[model samples]
Target chain A: MRRQITGFSNPTVKHLRSLREKKHRKAAGQFMAEGLRLLTDALACGHVPQVLVMGEQRDPHPLLAKLEAAVERTGGEVIETSEEILSKITGKDNPQGVAGVFAEFDTSLAGIDRSAANIWLVAQALRDPGNLGTMLRTGDAVGAGGLILIDDCADPFSVEAVRASMGAVFTQKVAQASWGEFLPWLRSGAGQLVAASLRDAVPYRGAPYAAPCFVLVGNESRGLPEDYEAACDLRVTMPMKGRADSLNAAVAAAVLAYEVLDKVDS
Target chain B: MRRQITGFSNPTVKHLRSLREKKHRKAAGQFMAEGLRLLTDALACGHVPQVLVMGEQRDPHPLLAKLEAAVERTGGEVIETSEEILSKITGKDNPQGVAGVFAEFDTSLAGIDRSAANIWLVAQALRDPGNLGTMLRTGDAVGAGGLILIDDCADPFSVEAVRASMGAVFTQKVAQASWGEFLPWLRSGAGQLVAASLRDAVPYRGAPYAAPCFVLVGNESRGLPEDYEAACDLRVTMPMKGRADSLNAAVAAAVLAYEVLDKVDS
Candidate 1:
């Protein structure tokens, strides 16, 4: 059923506003996926929203109707809110016409089907939400089986990270673990682990990446810890011919991911 | 000789602060390159600073001495101000210890040595400063001869762009021209023009990228205009196997740039 919310002080409005913070998102086990395209992508991925919020000025579009039907089918309520309310809920000057509050689906490392999973991207202490999200999108692009976040990484469900993922947040299986926990899980899987490092590594192009591999990227500033780099099955370096010592973490991940895909396909 | 200015109201201090804006940078024909690494890169690129500013808390170091000596040899002054003054000048709560004001070097298409220049990156109406700068860094990493910004692109000298470039702004040749102007210059050069487009394009890996090629990338939102795509000698598309319609502009550029390098080297 569709409900009309005329004021910002409504209880539902207050509930949606609280989701802008990580604590509330965690407590509620939900995150806000804003904009029309993200909501559409979430629905397409079979992620039904807990609540759908739309601006009062939103036109009667087929996509919006489809989203409303999806939410209704899932026993969720759709609320039409004024622009001011929508903006307040989104913490933006002008919020997109639609936003969906969906439940978080964090998977465990043990839950993944090993037979179907070939490649995994493991990011260690990745601090930038945008970089983490872009890696998720890139991992999805290259058809990686899953993403593993290790030790003090940014929240994958954060608004900035979700926005940067461009809907890959819905399709990609995200697993979180500590360095110690991840090492054992990785060893049990028996996949080749390729780490990108600048020190004492073979050229990335020349590295032989066997199947069922996990490509590990390091943090933005400090990079992979020395112990972690040493632990990997193979260490590879992307050539840097310019004055800059390193490439952006997300860019490095994309390049390496595509290269891995090429090698696997060949 | 090294001189120190302690006041926030000093004329040199005011001049350095003005460079934060594009208009002031244009009027003075100079831009501020912040942080120790950027200043070092500028000096290495033979760009003698007009002024060097440092926070009072900065420790005396050999690198500082070398930079001061270089500035003195070029008839430039080195000033030391309080942390408060440096913060105000940089618009950051905690500005880097060192910053340099250097003259802008805008190259023209006619000035480039056609015989020596093998690859050039052409960005049309790129809006984000960070994306533009990342492309510059990637171009530099691939040993691209230069970067060409066409029509309504972000200023390369903007602080965000420069910081994102990670010193590539100092080493890479940057040229700016309108589409009308660039088309004629490109035609006169008689080099291959490969446009990265989504429509009716061959796979990027399979595309034949001849030497002395100009790889054209489009704006973040709208992408390349249809006419521009039609005008290119060849059009290539990066494979997208995910829900996202397109890759981030910088990632796409990096992937394509590396592919071009791989093809050339092989």
Candidate 2:
């Protein structure tokens, strides 16, 4: 049996709404995942929610029932609330029926399993939440070990990013570190550092992407700075035939990541 | 000398605002291309703006001066407006210093130079403007001949879509058609049709994308309808190793487009 809450001012609803803000999310050490698909992905990825909220659907869908059972099995509270309250929390006119508040997965640079993982993605100063999420999803798709956010990247836990990530947010490990801290790790001879740059680079397809590789992509606008490019073991460029100078950051990342995967497997 | 307009209620400003709406764009057969880079791309692509608007800058950038010269050379009017007016027209706090109102490039299925082109992109019922723009940019990167928008799709001329295109909108030929009208032409020995589908498909890389190929991508949400899949000469799927069921529409398009380009060139 689940509790029913009709009031919008409920403490749980307030907490869920607060998760929308970065400050609150950081303070509470939790983030909100909306929609049945995201919640199911969260659970499948071994992330148990602290709280699950569902809208008042008179006859609950089978998937909803399964999700509810999974929550209960994990000792998480399940609340059946009015659609209005769910919409309020999600800030959408007609929100998805299911939402979950889950503790953020804590990943550290020291915790990454370098021995077992061959490929990694490093995003520097990425600002767009949607692009960050798309990169996370692409990273997961290519079986990258994890993502490292170097200096002032968009919050991966934000609603826009989480939504854009689909379910990859739960599956991919994400770490935050400054360039100064990350440089030592790259120079530690753990792997090859491949940077995507527009200057003095071999074509991406022609580059020999050795195993245990870390592919570095830069900000959407500025790209990888000169010093950062110099630090990389190899630099690769994608061919551009049109007037536009660059591909979208995430698109470039996907193309590079997939190329690396193809070469590695071959 | 360029005309100086300071009033927000000026007819030119009103007309510029109206271009934001689809109805107005369709009626006028024109769209707004904002930002210096996009305007420059438009001019480089041989698209003469009907009107060019520049925000008041104490010292105009050299690029701005060059753009004004080009517009004047093409017998187009250049207007210098206050930043506030520019900002209001664009709905951005700090709008780019330059914008251009250009007539839409009228492309029809009958007008495409299929004989000279090897690759094309076909988007069916794509709803998101950003994804559409990204696809345009990706298509340009791969040197696709043109893009065909099938059935009901978001207006490619929308500001969001154009901005997302990163100025590729000027270089790429875009045509609109219904599915009923497209199938006959597709089967008229025009080209090979390759559709991306998750069902009964080989890996995308394995697909034999022969020359004069039209790579088809479905909508962001529903994907291609079953009958549409059946209509395709070949169906291909991208390998997804993670929990995500599908890649971002734009990312998927980029990956497939590049793969096609690689095979065609080899």
Candidate 3:
């Protein structure tokens, strides 16, 4: 049933506020996604929003109504609330007047067909949420097979990450695991392994690409974990002659992903 | 004069804390930089720290004595304080036990001989500080003639930018100006102008590099301003085959910079 809750003290608003805190997100098994773009992307990707909340002053954006209809088709609930209530719920400087609570995806790497997929990305210890989000968006653009983040990575579901990702978070398949779990694939010879490093790695442009190869990138402040670097079949470095020795994680991911396609096509 | 400030409540510590506020940063025409790497880079570039603070239990790293000696030589003040005081000044979740205040540099285009410099970067409305900082560091590596920032850019001295730049902020010559002030050179044919855009522009690799050129880039969310786009001698687009239509600002800058050098050296 759709309801218009005007007061900030409303129960629905309170529940939305809880989503910002990590503990609550875990407890609810859901997280809040604000803005029409993200919600639309989530819906288009077969993810259903548990509840769709809209501000009374604003009708759903044209595309948003189609998304809401899709949500209802999935037997989800949609509600309208006051702007004040949304402001209180979002804990954001500017509320987008639309927000949704969606189920947290438990995407895992179990039984994935690596040989068929052209390219995959392996992120090692990337700690910044914004960087991770951007990586996901870039991954979506390149039609990546999937993204596997080794332990000690940022939560891609964080608001900052989601915002920076520009809606790619919803479209990509992401899984987080330890280096131990990833070792079997590295040794499988099913694909090539390229590790981006600061020292002694080949230029990224020239790195060889075999089917099902996974490019591993490290943390922003620190390079990849020692164990992960040792696991790579080949190490590659972006040829940097400028003052900065490294590129932003997302940028590196995009460049390498393009290189993968370039090599495969040629 | 160098001094030892013991308590968190010390007046100097309080003043340092105030500098964390943007208003104070602007009012004093100064900024704060943290971590040993940035401090060392600042000193290396002949940019002296006005005040240096270290944790009580902290011994300067391998470069400390040299840094302190250099500080003394430059007529700068040094202070030793408890870790608690350093924490108060930095307000970072994890304090590195080192912090310093340095006079903001205002490198003008006036003294720089643009024609002789040959290579340069113009960041148009880059909103992310980290992107700008990373671009600066990369610019330094490539030996860019200078960095010119358009309006609405992040303060390169902001803590996040400094951390991401990995100390390139101090080494690079940066000039902040509006399009009107910075574009006269391009108009006068002092140098070629190459603008990065998503408009099916010529591939970066094919772009000509005959003389000094300003590689212009825009904000992460927006491409170059219309007027700026119309002014470019050529609009170059990085070859992107994936779903992502574009690259991160810094990464695009790095690729474009490399492409410029590629054309010149070829």
lDDT of 2 by residue, A1-266 (tens): 68999887889889899999999999999998888878888877888788888888746677677778888998889988988999999887878888889898786777677666667888999998988999999988888878888989999999989988887888888888999989897777678889888888999986899878888899988998899999988999887877767888899989888888887754
lDDT of 1 at A238: 78
TM-score of chain B of each: 0.95, 0.96, 0.91
Q: Please give the CA lDDT of all the candidate structures.
A: 0.84, 0.86, 0.75
Error of 3 at B220 (Å): 2.7
Q: How do the candidates rank by TM-score, highest first?
A: 2, 1, 3
TM-scores for the candidates: 0.92, 0.94, 0.92
Residue B27 of model 1 has an lDDT of 98
Residue B262 miss distance in model 1 (angstroms):
1.3
Model 1 accuracy (lDDT, Cα): 0.84
Predictions in order: chain A TM-score: 0.96, 0.95, 0.91
**Candidate of highest TM-score:** 2
> Is candidate 1 or 3 superior in lDDT?
1
lDDT of each residue in B1-266, candidate 3, tens digit only = 55889877778888888887777887887888888877877777777787887777876478777777777887888898877778878887668877778887775556456675667888998988888877776677566776788777888767777777777778667888778877774565578888888674786765776558778889897777777888888888766544457667777776677667556543
Error of 1 at A100 (Å): 1.6
> Between the candidate structures 2 and 3, which one is better when assessed by lDDT?
2
- Per-residue lDDT tens digits for candidate 1, residues B1-266, read 55677777888778888988999999999888888877888788898788888888998888778898999898997888888899988888979898888888866767565456567788999988888888888877888877899899999998888888888888888988999998988888658888888888998885799878888899987889999999999899876767776877788888887777776654
Candidate whose lDDT is highest: 2
Model 2: lDDT to the true structure: 0.86
